[model samples]
Target: MHAKPSYTEAQLIELLKLKNQRAYNYLYDNYSAAIYGVICKVVGDEDEAADVMQEAFIRIWRNIEQYNADKGRLFTWMLNVARNLAIDYIRSAQSRKSSKTESLTESTPLGAPGYTDAIKIDHVGLNAVLDKLTVEQKKIIDMAYFQGYTQEEIAEELDMPLGTVKTRARAALMKLKHLFV
Candidate 1:
């Protein structure tokens, strides 16, 4: 296996700012799998996740100049970019599903093959475990995981400090992990 190149965050930022192709190649080699996994978990489909991940990389490249170290690490910013795109995809899908349901209800041929209520078996267990979490834990976990809100966005919505959001998110993750494992 080829080893990935490591660069300090500052060095990475400088390289990316200069539009160094090597830096971009290093980034994809190292981070694409992690980003793809996150997108897949959020979108719950490999195909859609791949689509979102591609768009996210484009966005990250396009917005490299806007990154600020004082705000957070570059990876965190990139993760948010990927996550926000995934969440946007989810929202857009939900909107389309709702619209489709409306149209289907209005006029659909009798005995349609794809006209049944499908059960999302994965979510049943997830919701059960989520119910066991504390209110704070559940809120933070839901907004971040299911809703794909960034830590900064969560803090802004909850009016809490970024550190506190991180702490709660960590706690919530541990709690959920314990329940599942």
Candidate 2:
């Protein structure tokens, strides 16, 4: 059996306030295994528990300043964060699973009218405006919004610097906004 940790909750809180790595590591050493066990109990997978455990600690570290002695105990706050993260992860996995099932099985026709019909563009006018844009701008905007590529992903895919990709995307969006307005 391992020896019990010597640091008091107040001492650990002070170390955390100072952003001391040793204090953080000590907290992790003392608490992470227990937290991971709780997460595994909820999530039923070691991998998911590990991931949620990391996320929980990250959130705890980031929000250390928000912790209050008067509100509750430190361990209580930490456990709450862990449990919440595990629950959120499970819910997100379920949502993704349902979305995949819907996508695979649903049979919405191509000509189906979605709710945004009032905002729908005339194909000819939309094509004309799109033709006015530079190819680089068009490609970046299409990938970023329509295809859901993040700015960094777009930059890496296009072999361009990340800042250039962001600037071009913003400019393209501005141009599109002006056209729509």
Using all chains and alpha carbons, the TM-scores for the candidates as numbered come to 0.60, 0.51
C-alpha RMSD between model 2 and the true structure: 16.7
Error of 2 at 66 (Å): 0.7
Q: lDDT winner among the candidates?
A: 1
RMSD of each: 10.2, 16.7
Model 2 lDDT tens row, 1-181? 5555568999999999899888898999888766775576456567767888889999999999999989999998888788778766765775767652242123122222222222245446656786777777877765543234567778777899989998898899888888877
Clashes per candidate, residues 3 or more apart or on different chains: 0, 0
Worst 10 residues of 1 by lDDT: 108-117
Candidate 1 residue spans exceeding 4 A from truth = 1-4, 99-143, 149-181
